[model samples]
Target: MKHPVTPDGRYFAVRCRLWRMVNPDLDEAERSKLTKRLMVARRAVRDAKAARDPEAEAVAHRAVDVAKRALGERGPVWWKDGSPDLNRRIAKNTPYADWYAQVTRSRHGGS
Candidate 1:
């Protein structure tokens, strides 16, 4: 499924949050791989927004497809309700809070 995008053109915050959850345990190589995947996905979304390009849309969809497949292949690490855990974890980390705050503030203009 396509990831949800915010009305103001930002990708949903949950996508970033979820992506960060995979960061802690990765080796440098793994982190680089994940970052590259995210960059491709992000660029695809940006391109789609810019011109309604079908190729861009496909790239974004493929990114999610790869992610879901990887998650399934790995088996369940946490339950489906892991969002609460993720939120709590991020809340406890100052860097995460700083990043989240910046993204949110930019997206909503300090609303």
Candidate 2:
């Protein structure tokens, strides 16, 4: 269960944080619950790292992933209609590029 120490995990953690800021869909109660779970999982990650326990770290990582997924940061899309994932890249390299650009432009009034 020892997950590799990759920068990807940290990146995901940061993504979870940033996404949470913009995600207003969750009501107060649900948001509170998920926030608590995220805090506990994050603490576990820190503790496991301090103890140098890779297996424990991996388990904690899973917890973190679960928490983030529940917060709609790292898992299946909440919407059912297969809408573009705004959380992903906006580059022309991806299929969502045009849609993403439109959404971004609309949000920013970029014409």
Instruction: Find the candidate with the highest TM-score and give its number.
Output: 2
Candidate 1 local lDDT, 1-111, one digit each (tens): 243322322122463542323423447786667667767776777789788888878879788557633433223443353532332233325334655666666767884
lDDT, candidate 2, 1-111, per-residue tens:
121111212111121121222134778899789989999999999999999999999999999888888877767666556655534442344443454455456656897
- The C-alpha lDDT values of all candidates are 0.51, 0.59
Residue 77's lDDT within candidate 2 is 64
> Considering summed lDDT, which 10 consecutive residues are worst modelled in model 1?
3-12
Q: Per model, how many backbone clashes are there? A: 0, 0
TM-score of candidate 1 versus the correct structure, residues matched by position: 0.40
Stretches > 4 Å off in candidate 2: 1-23, 86-111
